[model samples]
Target: MTHRRAREAAGDKDVLVLGVDVSRQMLGSGLLDEVHLHLMPVLLGAGAPLFAGVRAELLPLGEPVGGAATHVGCSVVFGP
Candidate 1:
């Protein structure tokens, strides 16, 4: 679905999007308020690149919560 359609479909509920390309599209859509990223330590030799086509923007992050993986919270900033 397109971003506008997704936004309309979402209403007031939070939607979690998985995968790099979709995430990039969502980030560019200006419909997200915040993002939670789960960071794990592992190495896969070849894969899709994160932030491959994302524009330059600053996401203000909260202090990370650590566990088997680190959870980071960030608020999206939509303008230059």
Candidate 2:
């Protein structure tokens, strides 16, 4: 999914991109939310990356306040 979708999926809070390293023998995994899991297909031959350049702003989740079903978390807004 696109970053905007990811942000929307993540709710109204800001989205952060965490750094993850993967090896040819190791599996690559990503987390979008508690409901979804992000994974990439296996590549056996010499190939290029699925994504070229990605630019993102850092947004920290400051406070979380809400009920079990809904939440309003404090986040530093950063984007275009």
Candidate 3:
């Protein structure tokens, strides 16, 4: 089954994270209400790339929030 199709079969409300490659393939394939990401401080030399193929825009969620990067939760804006 296609990446998107498989994800759909998994049912909605399932917060799934695909690899960069799979994400790229499944990008823009389904409707996502909101995506939450925990922005953690510290960066690795190399790691999997998120949103490599995602086309949705990311907007901050909740009140005006800013931190040192220890941990930050973000919301992604879906749809045009």
The candidate that wins on TM-score is 1
lDDT of 1 by residue, 1-80 (tens): 77677768989977777877787777776656777788888756676675665554557586889999999878877765
Better of 1 and 2 by TM-score: 1
Model 1: residues with Cα > 4 Å off, grouped in runs: none
Give the per-residue lDDT of model 2 (tens digit) for 1-80.
55658778989775655333221111122323221123345545675543233222324354334343333332222224
Cα deviation of 33 in candidate 1 (Å)? 2.7
The TM-score that candidate 2 achieves is 0.23
Superposed Cα deviation of residue 7, candidate 1 (Å): 2.3
lDDT scores in order: 0.73, 0.37, 0.57
User: What are the runs in model 2 whose C-alpha is more than 4 Å off?
Assistant: 20-80
lDDT of 3 by residue, 1-80 (tens): 65467667888647576455555445466445445555556676776676665667766566545575433335556555
Each model's total of backbone clashes? 0, 0, 0
